[model samples]
Target chain A: MRVQAAIEVAAPPETIWELVSDPARYLHFMSGITRWEIAGEHARGLGARYRTLMRVGSAEIGGLVEIVECDAPRDLAWTSISGIDQRGRWRLREIGPGHLGERTRVELRLQYGVAGAGILGWIAEQVAAPAVRKNLRRSLQELRRQVEHEQARAAAATRRAAARN
Target chain B: MQAQTARASSGDGHAADGDPFARDFDEHEAGERPPAQPRRGPLERLVDAAATVIRGRVPAADLDERDPDFIRESLPAQWLLASLWFRGEVRGLGHVPEHGPVLLVGNHSGGNMTPDTLVFTLAFSTYFGVERRFYQLAHNLVLSWPGLGFLRKYGIVAASPDNAERALSSGAAVLVYPGGDHEVHRPSWERNRVSFDGRRGFVRLALEHDVPIVPVVAIGGQETALFLSRGEGLARRLMLDRLLRVKVLPISIAAPWGLNVGDGLGHIPLPAKITIEVLPAIHLREQFGAQPDVDEVYAHVTATMQETLDALAAERRLPIVG
Candidate 1:
């Protein structure tokens, strides 16, 4: 089953990219994720690995996933290496600077299927897809909130620095 | 006189407008105001008022009204004992999620008077604050005592499926000792062992609630008293199990009480200098398959706790002194 969600964050794409790329900070902004920790020495970008546990209904489904694609400030993707078979991607696009603020459209997509359960897998997916979509939406909303907050803080700090100078 | 008349007319108009009963009265002056819907009994009204007050004081769904105040008052003394006398060291508290429900599974030690339980409860309530809704599941007998209203106030509920479910549903971190009295009363020589008496209800609870299971491993509790035997056969012969739901009738050497049998009444717990290590959380469905085997989950949790306990034991050069 595939589930996706997007949000228009009032921040630059680079700001959203910085937050999403770091594995350590994933727990802070990811919804319905019970665990997301670095599984190996590599921390970020391609080749980095993470052990993730995502809550699906009354169960947590996840495994060791490795970064398969990393396009800085634009896109990042990962593929499952063991446990549950899955792929997840994060896409950020600049929606052009507006009079109100700079807006970035952030989209998260997850494609997952149980490796060995066959018909049971299909049934489980059918039951869990809606929940997964809701989780995705919540995750995106949290991401937007975090990115916007970070951007605002950064802008305020920059202004302070300029004033000090 | 004209202004007073106008004001009186307006007042009457406002009264008629505000009261629907008055409108009905005007429509049917003959019909008596529908008998004030049977007034609730005084006892029921008082009960409702008390419930409202309790709910306001204790916002958590399953917590007792006096829990926050009791924990605050007891924390200072418990902290002093934990830090100074017991030299209790807590680690990996960061592994606990900042929010949401979680199951804290640990091996229970130190017969009836568990210093480890006290130390952990103090540390947890201190770290998370009393408002975060944390409950410790204890045997029904523990909560049965009349004077232990203090225990209830500190969110110690009787270990039952219903109680556990209520705590979890309320998004409280529930600390459970699957070992129960059996492991706590094990011979002191077997202090390093992490035994749950093969209880797997904790795993089922975690799976049912879909919460992360954080294994809490503590050593030195068993060293508080010199446990001679579990006396399971004795308890069985005496029918204590059937009569009181008491599984273990432990014979232990302790201060004051030379030989303690069925230390359910509790004894003076020697300060054993407990060290608790909280292990990383394990999601059952994630580690194992979606339909994970209960035995497998139990084994995984106990093994992890055992390994950590062994490591902590290795660090202690002397018993009780640790």
Candidate 2:
């Protein structure tokens, strides 16, 4: 099944990419994520691998996933290397004309299922769609909240620094 | 769960019924069998012939029979049963060793239809991908039952020391429930208890294999039906222990069969919320001594499991709603 969730963030795509690309920040902003560990030497960019697990229903479902597409500040995608078959992507787009840095639209899409599992697999995917979608939506809201809050904090710090100077 | 029947196969060309493990463990535990009543009637002969056929159907333990592809394909059905039907929640799977052979000792519950096993199997399979060689020990009866041949594909072999040793020798994790049919058919009021009935063969198995033992505690299965008794007396009088190698003829009040007896045909288990907790692995040689005492290890394991079961039981405010 395919599930996607989108939200508008005040910061630019680079800011969102910074948070999403760093494996360390996953547990903080990603809902239902139980484990997110760097599997190999490389941490980010193409070829980087991660052992990820997400709590869906009664099981922690995920596996080793490699970064197949990493377009820096715009798009990031990964496909499963083992465990459940999955393909996940993070898309970031400037919200409006000439307001690229001021606002951005972020979407997290995931396509996951057990290949060759037949009718029951199809049914299970349908049944698990709502939970997966909810987690994605919450994760986006959390990402927006953290990024916007960080930007506000940085702006306040800059104002205080200027006044002190 | 008292599927204490020993290895059905002696690895010889002879019939499995003549196997020593089946006779030694099954009959020794049940005591002396009563004298033969009379000559078999026509109905009795037919039933005997059918039993003989079923007994012949039990397959020999072949580690290669465990097909990871088949297990992966069947996981969805198991997941639906565990997630929707049982509403299972499993915690602390990380406590189990991530790799290598280890013994998983669990308390069995939920008569003939073991929902606990179903929930735990799904959780284990999903947690540690199907690629890992994970096997479960089941009673010969369960293995010989018609249409359950697919269970072999799920990596379940007849409960026997040789089978377990073989699985472990192959560096695969093996799950065993010492309580077996005895504790599984316990009265509903005693659901919170972890009664292994002094069977410490699992301790010996782990010690022999030189592997760690992981205790798996679960609750809410006994709530699936109103279990009345294990019916040991009836089984003794009927000589089921000697004839079929079955110790108990359980009686319960369950769905479709209001006054279910024997439960050989199984029954519909109520939608009980099952919660399983996997305790940390106990390296016997390290924790106990270089020469660990079987009795001590058994006591420690049972105590630890009972404590966890108590905590799970206390958290429950109701029976099947659990």
Q: Evaluated with TM-score, which candidate comes out highest?
A: 2
Work out the TM-score per prediction.
0.54, 0.91
In CAPRI terms, model 1 is classed as incorrect
lDDT of 2 by residue, B1-322 (tens): 2233223333212224554444433433444444566987776677566656656676788889999888888888888888999899999999999989999999988998888888888888877888889989887778777777888887888887668778999999998887887888999989999988877778877888899999999999999999999999998777565456567999999998999999988899999999999999999999999999988998999999999999999999988898
Off by over 4 Å in 1: A1-165, B1-62
Native contact fraction, candidates in order? 0.00, 0.61
Residue B208 in model 1: shift from native, Å?
A: 1.1
How many clashing pairs in candidate 2?
5
Question: C-alpha displacement of B222 in model 2, angstroms?
Answer: 0.7
DockQ of each: 0.01, 0.68
The candidate that wins on DockQ is: 2
B1-322 in candidate 1: lDDT tens per residue? 0000000010121223544322322332124223444787776466546534432332222455436755655554555556656778777766888799999987878887787777777667645555678888776556554455567777776565556677889899988887777777889999999877666667777887899999989898888889999998897666554344455689999876888877756777787889888889897788898898878887888888888988998999999988
Cα-based lDDT at residue B1, candidate 2 = 27
Q: For candidate 1, give the DockQ.
A: 0.01
